[model samples]
Target: MTAHQNGTIATEVSHFLLNCFVRSPSWQLWLSLPLSLLFLLAMGANATLLVTIWLEASLHQPMYYLLSLLSLLDMVLCLTVIPKVLAIFWFDLRAISFSACFLQMFIMNCFFAMESCTFMVMAYDRYVAICHPLRYPSIITDQFVTKAAIFILARNVLFTLPIPILSSRLHYCGRNVIENCICANMSVSRLSYDDITINRLYQFALSWTLLGSDLILIFASYTLILRAMLRLKAEGAVAKALSTCGSHFILILFFSTVLLVFIFTLLVKKKVSPDVPVLLNVLHHVIPAALNPIVYGVRTQEIKQGIQRWLKKGW
Candidate 1:
């Protein structure tokens, strides 16, 4: 418990989602209560979103179908890591084995990749529906959506699985403890005594390619939608069009800020205090999970009515 061959860095990391300083006050501090609430809020909102779509036949259209898929992705994304995250915050700081950590990272990256791909598909779906409403059904069939989803899954798996391969090859001379909350790639890579040049290069390239492409496609679709809305020549059409896009735009902005903040924090020129970076990381994880569902629910009337109906039936 006292010495290490690597260096004199007095680091004792628990193998858990939340790498709280155990020597300090217990992890069940006041802040944790609100985080727990935020986690529950995310789960409930996503569950309500899925239930609303399924219960309403009027919402059985292709647009709602894609929304439900997005909700499902969000649900799975939260479920995969949030349980472990909460466990660390509430219970003991559970240690993540090397394999378990790799698996969690892989799955997290897969869902993130899948979510990005789904947005591109959704952008195209919106484009077809708005730009060519008459041919919406012909252009976006149930069979087509199924095939598209499959392709998205295949592409994400093919590209992202290599991350673990690269990760596994690296050896951890000391305990496999990650700083900050999650087993983030950056955090893990910092510990490696081996070369990480190629891994870092690939990560940079992939982030630029995937997230950049999604943002480009999303903007392109909105441009086309705006053109169509203008051509409609109806006064209310502009308002309605903005309403339709508001939720998706919010998601894009939220994610982009998280990415930028996390990346920029890493690039800070000054002496970036440790706690600041960790809090930024927490935002990247928590804010989206907490705010997204509220954004979607407040913006969509159909979801509100469905929730009301479900509540009435329950009572």
Candidate 2:
């Protein structure tokens, strides 16, 4: 394309206005309060977890390394989605430049997939720890965590990179309003003048391929874990084993369930208000981020003790 042609395309797709739930001007103030609180909680919780893991030498292990990675992903996810949402709600800063929108879309897609992969890896950590306790030191090593981190980063980034690139290449022709909070794939793609069949199909396949595989592996890991726990001779042993993984399982369940519901709501958009999926998307980012560290800190003995030791040393 010539400079003129590129300029024309840029003009056609200059900015996108994001939609919000509160159409009334008076309600934005009230809405801002809770949204701000959630953002703060998500950041504060994840930051504390990361800092604790960083300072404590005892936490320098494969499992805690994975937990730190989860905290990092959650922090990035919250940062990617929430501040802009709060800006929209509070200052009505809804007009996002075309380049910024695609960048946001890329980060959101990449991080979410990475987060799901982190959960899957954590489940594998638990599985090895429980199902093959004697060999866990050999199986779940620092090298293993390093490989898993690289895999999560590379796999998700490579697969999700095309989504925003494809979305950005479409001709807009002046209808640039995105009817959602974040730059969701379908929501942004539908604004284009071009047919988005391939975009839609790719998104569907990507969602299922990454998340579906993770969910299946997570389920299988937990199943083997439960079976192993059931075979323990002592009742206390069974209880302890369940307690170790219960928090992670709950967080994974909530994370995957909310996301799956959001995807279904996307399919049935005709029946539900757009606000439903928007709110779900917003909560989907913050809720698990805020809860993951808390659940693990309270339930996982090592993390609980680590937090206690860190607190004893002062903040």
Candidate 3:
């Protein structure tokens, strides 16, 4: 091809090659099996939890509704990223179209923020249930859940829509290789020939502002819940409170820890292996998803009994 044609193709790059762990072809075979299993586990677990919640009329409450929302978000996240990753690993099909890549980027960015917002709302639900029992019925009604769902969608969509828009506007000249499993905002933006200062700054500011605020609110809600729990005078009240909040706390801890680790790895990308952040990013999507429903099913007695009933009915 002539230099002119090369430049033209680069400028009008229609697709990108995802170099997902391409440095270790042998590892792809090993990674493919486990990733596939995790994907299946996440789908099945979340599906079961959703079905259990739907069928069990007794479980029709704000908390379970929020849990269903979380499951839905997890399933969307997994579906958005995992199938393409598995395809890349198993069949060596690394090419993703330009539009598809940006669409994936949008879903990843938007859904993650939506999940964080959902967690924050769930914390509020728990707060009302544990701290203000009398008002819990009034405050966390089906109407309230519906409003929260709307807020989650609106807030995340309004803020996150621009990430892909900003990223997609940048010009790509000859370099079309993305060095990660998914079209992470930065991973895609960095491949562009255009200056991405605005893109980076917007993403950084938005991420910290959106997710950071959610974390702060969640922490505050739990703090109040803990204070309320400590003031309990009834026998086994504290134990019961702990049991109630334990599952949520565990999921929040894991979610925050993994996200913080991924951010840290990105900050020190120059010092660490390039694949470290990539691996963390990939696991962050699947591990928590697979764990969320399992943790809830095991820790919450209502959910467990509901699952048993669901299974019995299935049989």
Candidate 4:
């Protein structure tokens, strides 16, 4: 029996029942195969990318380090959200404990912010390499990458830790059904009977302040990079620069574009199907991960060669 049907308010709900596509069971059947395939592909590809970078001594550079960090983030994200989702799809396991839900929420928010920070750092790396070629070595050293990684972790944690904490403190009187696959912040918070004004306000402020700033800085870095490439008078300078940045550019574009779409669909949820945002949210977690290594392998010659060498050695 549900809390509403029990006559008294159950203030302490033990778990949340994730109703992934509860309105349409058919959708779960349709999505199960594709999502499983994407999850496997993401895991395999990211693992390959990480191993190739680790074994290939030639890839010991700031740029490749950041790429490996991206792959790691992708793998973490896939692991955090996909396994539970697949469980729900295949075996109807949707009972996520209260603590586990909050944990998932924290990781999702923190890692996403970290990924954005990584992209911003990558853009700066590109800017330095293209706009100030001579200073790239000194500015983007191994120590510099280490410092940037530290900053990414500290900054994102400081900013995102409050989200789950705030949500968890809310009084969940009765409802424990989450309408999405993963424990999305707002989705989980909305289940509580208490006023979520502070939660919403803080999330909005953090999203704008953190992600907005990263986007602005990434745009500025790329703008400078484009201007630098334009002024190159050498016959192959522009092409070479494009080749160097093409993979990063494409990856970031997809990342930012999908994120913006998810945000948009969320904002206009009243006008769209409820499942649209949930589906986008799920895809947002997996698609970029699946694409990252593939895109790099196709566009970046060094990584391609590294993968080839690794395969030959394995065989």
Best by TM-score: 4
**Global lDDT scores for all candidate models:** 0.73, 0.87, 0.91, 0.93
lDDT of 1 by residue, 158-252 (tens): 88887767866765555555775666676676676668887788777877887788889888898888888888877787787778777777876
- What TM-score does candidate 4 reach? 0.97
Candidates 1 and 3, the one with greater TM-score? 3
State the lDDT of candidate 2 residue by residue for 141-240, as single tens digits. 9999999999999999999999999999887766778888889888999987678999999998998999899999998999899889888997599888
| Order of candidate numbers by TM-score, starting with the best | 4, 3, 2, 1
Mind giving the per-residue lDDT tens digits that candidate 4 earns over 94-186? 999988999999999999999999999999999999999999999999999999999999999999999999999987767789999999999
For candidate 1, what is the TM-score? Answer: 0.86
Candidate 3 global lDDT = 0.91
Residue 76, candidate 4: alpha-carbon lDDT: 95
